[model samples]
Target: MPKFLIVGATKFEIQPLLTYFKIPVHSPEGLFSTESGPDISALITGVGMVNTAFALGRYSHNLFDYIINAGVCGAINKDLKIGEIVNVTNDTLSEMGAEDDSEFIKYPDLNLPGTNYYENQVQIISSALNGLRKVSGITVNTVHGNEQSIAKVRRLYEADVETMEGAAFFRGCSRLSENYFQLRAVSNYVEKRDKSKWQMPLAIENLNSFLISLIEELEK
Candidate 1:
């Protein structure tokens, strides 16, 4: 059985997972072992790109067969349903670029400066992931909430979803493990800030449900 690590941005986002596995570490600090399934572990790396990078880097020395990043994301493509889960095939820091007047010079186009575009790395798409919609994503420090910024992003990248730590996780995963996956569930559409319009509860519920099923499958 392959060892796995479920990486999440926040505890609340993966609270159900902790409950399901019956992990004793209530205030999960670091790598905690469990008899839940095929040597599975979890890391609650605060939030955003910086926190994720630091947390993953701190534990990079520990080898894992697979690293799966799970969380809720904003739907950039209106066709995606509110509670639907997706597999991010590619991701990049969309904001990491220099603005030359109206043109934005993306990181990949820049001279030899270690890329933030992290899809070139081969991902292990298991049977559980083949059914999921494989979509491109862009990670950001600040989620798009304003109309102008949202519109700008929509025009700039051909991404289907947006997450806070997907790219950062992918970048670290490039070195940490060969088999990695970034799973994101849509909680809301990228529109003007409207908490009333978001379905966070449903997204979290579905995300956790899938995680449970995934772990169960791993047990086999």
Candidate 2:
């Protein structure tokens, strides 16, 4: 049985899956298995890049055959429907650069050697998860609420969705595990920060349900 790690940004994002699997709640600092018979474990790495990196780093020694980072995200592409889950094959650290006056300069623009983006090479498109679209994403410390900022990011990267911890999760797993994935559900559009328009419940429900199915397939 291959050990699996299921990571989420918050309890709210993964609560449905936990309940559905009947996984008991445990300390967030360590890994715990699900009651349902597979060697699957989960972790809630609080909300941001720093927290995610730290949490993963703290548990870097643990062995996991596959690491799945699951959560809800805001869609940058209007074509993506609410409650739709997608596999993020690539992710960028959108704010890792300097701001010169009104213009933002990226790390690559500075002729930097380090990369600001990470790609998942072991992305598997099993029949159980093939229905979800594969898309690129951008991770930021601050979510896009201003139209001007959103447009700036759009010009910089062809990202389909935006999330707070996706890039960090990717980068961390890139160093720790050979097989990793990011699955995100679109909860709202990236145009403006309007909670009124966000379908959070629907997104969570759909995302968790898909996660449950994916885990079951992976276990087999």
Candidate 3:
């Protein structure tokens, strides 16, 4: 059986999938794996870029065939429905570059050799879950709730979703494994800071359900 690593920002986001897989809690602070079959494992990499990079770097000695970064994200594109699961084929480190006066300067603007973005060819095309849109995402240290900032980022990237740890996850996995995927569920629209409009529960439900099915397919 092929080994797989499932990563999430918080325990709450991946709790359902862990429970379904019956992966017992081993360490309170680090990685854990299932007792039987397939070498399926889970890691909760706190939140944001620094924590995610550190977590993956610390425990990435073992090799895995596939790494799945799963979480809830804020949807920038209005066409994406709340609670819809999406495959993030590409992700950018949106706030990695410097800000010159009122203008935001990206890595490319600085003549950097490497890119601030990462792309993967692995896709979610299982028959069990159909019509899950594949989209581009931007990972930011701070999620945009202000209209001005959101507008600026949307214009720059033309991305569909935004998450705190997507880019770091992609970077870590791409360096450590050949097959990597970023799967996200739309929890809220990128509007003003409105908790009332966010469908977190629905998003978590759909995300975990899809993850469970995807794991089954991969194991077979």
How many clashes does the backbone of model 2 have?
A: 0
Which digits, one per residue and each the tens of the lDDT, describe model 3 over residues 1-220?
Answer: 9898998888889889888888876554478899986688898888888899999999889798878899999999999999999989899998878888998888888997899988887644567544568899999878898999888997788899999999888888877988788889999999989999999999999999999988888778
lDDT of 2 by residue, 1-220 (tens): 8788998888788888777777787755445567667777788888899999998998898889889999999999999999999999999998998889988898789887898998887856578667778999999989999998888899988999999999899989988788899999999999878899999999999998988888778777
Cα lDDT listed for each candidate: 0.85, 0.88, 0.87
The residue ranges of model 3 lying beyond 4 angstroms of the native Cα positions read 26-28, 123-125, 128-131
Please provide TM-scores, in order, for all candidate models, with all chains considered together.
0.92, 0.94, 0.94
User: What TM-score quantifies how close candidate 3 is to the native fold?
Assistant: 0.94
Worst 10 residues of 2 by lDDT: 27-36
Q: Which lDDT tens digits does candidate 1 get at residues 115-218?
A: 76789345444577677888899999999999989889988889999999999998888898888888888999999999999999999999999988876665
lDDT for model 2 comes to: 0.88
The order by descending TM-score is: 2, 3, 1
Candidates 1 and 3 compared by lDDT, better number = 3
